[model samples]
Target: MDIPVRAHIERLLDAHASDGLSEAVEQAFRAVPRHLFIPPVALACRDDGPQIIDRDADPDAWWDAVYSRASIVTQLDDGATDIRAGSGDYTCSSSAPSTVADLLQRLELAPGHRVLEIGTGTGWTAALLSHLVGAANVTSVEVDPVLGAQAASNLAASGHAPYLVVGDGALGCPERAPYDRVHVTCGIRRVPYAWIEQSRPGAVIVLPYCPGFGTDHALRLVVTPDGMAYGRFPGFASYMTMRAQRPQRDQPARTDADKHHLTTRVDPRTIGHAPAGADLAIAALTGLDSLGQADQDEDGPRYRLWVSDPAVPRSWAVAVWRPGQDEYQIYQVGDRPVWEEVVAAYFRWVGWGEPGRDRFGMTVHADGQEVWLDTPDQVIGSEARSAC
Candidate 1:
């Protein structure tokens, strides 16, 4: 192994001790070289946004970024825009070293275990999986053809050739069925029934479950003999939504006359800045998604909270709060009472002793998914609805 690459792996291990990077996973990272998967010109990950790193312009800087703990953005706007431009919706990336290790640790992969990888973005993850399990036991699927071709090339260059399929990853590769483990890279709102049906009885599936609420969660599920998968959120994660599961929400443009103004004693920030457990309960109870935006103008700092039902195009509500105000004003204009629904969910969560995210779990079945608390039988909502 190269000294510089070894140094990077050591640094990642030291920094991410709390991430629970197992010794086997650390060895996999040591075996697979990170630089081989990244492009010459791409965006380096940042807290605010990604920045460009061009190998031709600055080899030292590019090399530094390639080995850093940060993720490198490989494609933007689904590769329609050049990566050098450095400004577009992030569509593809070589995931950060810490994120890779964290998810792989949750996977609990063993030697010779059959694995199915969803969203083979840069193929780095697939290559690592091939190293952990034999290349013959690994099957990776990518939704984009161009990315799929490039991933195939990257895997070959790295001296590992796993089964790569260019198709919708939402529909897991059924040709190679009964996998022992399923690893998903993209964030998904709905747990596809195809995955539950394709895996073995005791197979484990790990993915980032973005419920379109306050925060997203990293989910780990175990398949049962009855064709259902049950799991709990391990922690928080943010990732690009699966192409087929992207939310197409509509916030209707409205005039003052169209809006119905109401006032509430509950602070808008309470619901806007709620914890992950409350977020999950609210989404399951109401079947709605929400976002909070904070800004400062001449009138000082203000918070704007928007809630909507993605299924109902014209259904939405906004709650506005300004400093030094005892009560906030809510302007709602839609068929569904989104604000009311949120308030009800918030109180329900508070009544449940304010449970944390770990206390909540999800069960995915053929018709729909259900969110439960503590035990699988204690379901939160009466109706099963997929989180939007």
Candidate 2:
């Protein structure tokens, strides 16, 4: 006998009932057998941490993983690498059940509303949408052909026949125009205007808004008759980026022979101590990426905050704070003093009363998107050209 998957679903629903999981979503969870969509071997289960489950190697572990409240990495390196090998960039996944439930509740789906799903990794979400609406009303698009085919097989096995499209999800499926709701599973640095254009005037568009920073939050936008979609971010979520908008890894340039050095009394740790939405604000204000590392120096253990400009190669800066030091040392290279910009952004966030993610909103227009703190008229930053 195996562990009863429905039992696990009940437990999951109970755990998240107060966290916005709805009765309709609970019914869908009980209806879908997640194990059917997952491959038999080498499942990546993120319980306390990441654990690999090989069915042949350990059947019990595989079953537990299949039912666990964790996101399973279905494909890595865009399906180029074998799962048995055990290590690569996660390209696609079946999202954690709790995450799926929350997003579904936020969507506010009706009985016959048409939904357009971006990033049909395992078709689990599509199946759930089909359960809410009808299969004929769901259009799921996957960028990878292999994943698309696999998802199609999984959906068919589960007795669902949603319209599955194999193409660039960024472009969306226009033939099935004017979706009632647009739900994107993939994280994107920039929200594509095409998603808004394909939605009905009152349609809701939900997606993970990742500005290539510390964390991502779900952005819920409502399309308007004026050809714009605008709304606030409810909470945090981190998803893999759409392939087309994925950022290339740019290593810091070699030490500049003429590097500039300075010192600040504003302890480097202060910059690391971020308020609610400070990281997102900093990323938007300076257009830079940041990381913090703890290491030992000649004197003692030190904390270093690194800031780099991903778009401009060779631009980087580091601020180091050591024990008993009143001031932090800063070293900067390239044309931009990234550390200074980060510090300035931190002050700006502080000056704004340290607002949370809920206070932040996004507006997607025909030309581009704008991020605002409290209102659209007070735009913090705008990206004229989206990578997508």
Task: Give the best candidate by lDDT.
Answer: 1
**Number of clashing pairs per prediction, in order:** 0, 0
Which residue pairs come into collision in candidate 2?
A: none
Q: Write down the worst ten-residue block by lDDT for model 2.
A: 1-10
Per-residue lDDT tens digits for candidate 2, residues 112-219, read 999999989999999999999889999999999999999999999999899999999988999998899998899888877888889999999888888865567888
lDDT of 1 by residue, 1-388 (tens): 7787788767756767777778888788888888889999999996766779999999988888887778899999998999988898899999888888878888899988999999999999999999999899999999999999999999999999999999998789998998999999998888888899999999999999888878888899999999999999878777799999877755467666656888888888999999999998887788788889999989899999988877765777889899889999998876577899999999999999999999989898987888899988999853444454
Which pairs, if any, clash in model 1?
Answer: none
